[model samples]
Target: MLTQDSMPPSAKAIETAEDLSSIAFGFMASKALFAGLHVDIFSALADGPKSAEELAGAADIPINRIVMLTTALASVGLLTIGDDKKVQNSPAAQSFLSKQTKYDFGDYLRYQIDQQMYPFLLQLNAVMKGDLSDDAIASYRHWMADEEQASVYSESQHAGSLGPGRTLARKVDLATASTLLDVGGGTGAMTISLCREYPNLQATIIDFPNVTEIGWRFISEADLVDRVRYIPGNAVEVQWPGNQDAILMSYLMSGVPGDNVEELVHKAFDALAPGGKLMVHDFMVEEDRRGPALAALWQLQHMAFTPDAHSLSVGWLTQTGKRIGFDVDQVDNLIPAMTKLVVFSKPS
Candidate 1:
């Protein structure tokens, strides 16, 4: 069984003064990073290092203002200013934050966190105390119901999940699997990744109608439309395209109500053909819940807007899978400290 004591060293809670200070000023750091992305600071340095004046010229801002933002960005470890006063992207920033890189995920932070969740988080206290209306706490579902909101969120989510999806494709062996059912498959990110990894794989994605609309565009762009398709509706209520070789639920379990998680796992089990594999990937706390702070924080963020969302744990999922007549095959970190992957197999 997955246990807290066995968690990696990275999962430990903050205990030092530096960590405490970082946590306290975390919002400022987030905004600084967002501001850097907004002004295309990382992208501006993508070509080569530039002086503050050159950066200001590229971004069309005053040199003084550019320096101010760069100071903040440098303090946050995303940028570096050499003794020559030339600014350049840090390795991490250049790889994942700069638009020049194929691995760019700036939209994940820019659109999803900055534009959507950051604003909604202001109501966290009221929602926690039950002072908010049910409609308010469940605004995520409402967002999914609207075309524009769903498109924006889906695009950001697509950007974020693609990296994880690629990582998952490397971790999971689906060579023999010909069919996949991707539950809560936003923008077909995982499906596209899996299809690319396994040439013979054909997948069906189940998600909101509007989300599926955006997903089709992504699938077409990936040239996987013939191999991937979407069934638009809630995964819980919709008729799942079952009898599959594999079922993937990436980032789905945490967004759902606690009571629904077991049912969803059971549904995945029932939908799979005998010997089928089920892979669930999401933000998970340790059994003891001390934390890998990022995982806990993401759960809390979801709770602020999704009142019924579950804070999942490795032990909880292992127990649920075994109880549903599946054998736990493997449990490993999918996105390092943030998300986990639990794989289970049905007896043939």
Candidate 2:
């Protein structure tokens, strides 16, 4: 029989069990956050504080539900419940959740991440068995079949990438990079961010025709049509324009088959000029794989959705990069973590 001494120490055992339990119930928190976003809680509370009754009426949900959700949101630090029983966006929420802010990412949560990944996870058993039917996570076909679906998903994802794009601009120094090739840059969010940072830097984004069309609008809206250009083509098959100062592949590595990743990096190397940089930003887990829980979970999702593709770690990135004749410059872990920027430089 497993007694207290044989099993484990009571406090340590209880804490470990509680941690595992938290992971299992993680979806509950995600759904709650989604629910708060569904009713546009941050936006509703933007101008000032809002009572549960007011939020319920605005969202067309019951006050009880709003109270519960608001309490959850408050716990997550997305909102602050005041002494008057009124709630308002926390400083973080005001910056990133309120639709009124330029950095608002509510749609990205509601549409791109939650709507896209949640369904596949629901069929975890089938996915793990590698029996996921085509329709479960149709990468290109779904967007190509319907134009509205393409536009909505593309724009929402653009919003999702925008924050990271902005962070990339501020964090990375691109003063000397005059020309850049953005491989599989969806909607030109990162390109726009980089161009805004360096007025003289010009970027060309290569994406599918449908995505490029949407990206064109964003580039034009940014009044950077002259600086940021889009070329419609497949990254792996298409001829990358030669003599580039830098090549950027963001969130693309985790989508393609792992076997093809090295070849793809070689293609970028061939396309770069001497002293050029290659920037790869994507979801990555650490070598240990035991921790960095968020990234590990993301890698698991790729097991379900992306065939033959999975997250790459910083160590793997550096190792693969060196084998391909490039220097590992720096690895950056951006805000909110998981997604990382791996910069590689071609010898001058």
Question: Which one wins on lDDT?
Answer: 1
Native-to-model Cα distance after best TM-score fit, residue 92 in candidate 2, in Å: 2.4
Q: What local lDDT does model 1 show for residue 34?
A: 91
Give candidate 1's error at residue 178 in angstroms. 1.3
Clash counts for all predictions: 0, 0
Candidate 1 C-alpha lDDT tens digits along 1-348: 345466766545669999889778889989999988888888889998999999999999998899999998898789999999899999999999999899999989999989888988887899788898866765445679988889889999999989899999999888889999999999988898899999999999999999998899999999997899889888888888778999999988888777788999989998999999999999998887877778899999887877778889988989989998999898988887789999999999
Compared with the true structure, all predictions reach lDDT values of 0.89, 0.81
lDDT of 2 by residue, 77-165 (tens): 78899999999899988888889998899998888777766765666677667777877755543444466766777889899888889
Q: Estimate each model's TM-score.
A: 0.95, 0.89
Instruction: Report the Cα lDDT for residue 42, model 2.
Output: 87
* Whole-structure CA lDDT of model 1: 0.89
User: Which clashing pairs does model 1 show?
Assistant: none
Question: Model 2, which residues run further than 4 Å from truth?
Answer: 1-14, 134-137, 140-146
User: What TM-score does prediction 1 earn?
Assistant: 0.95
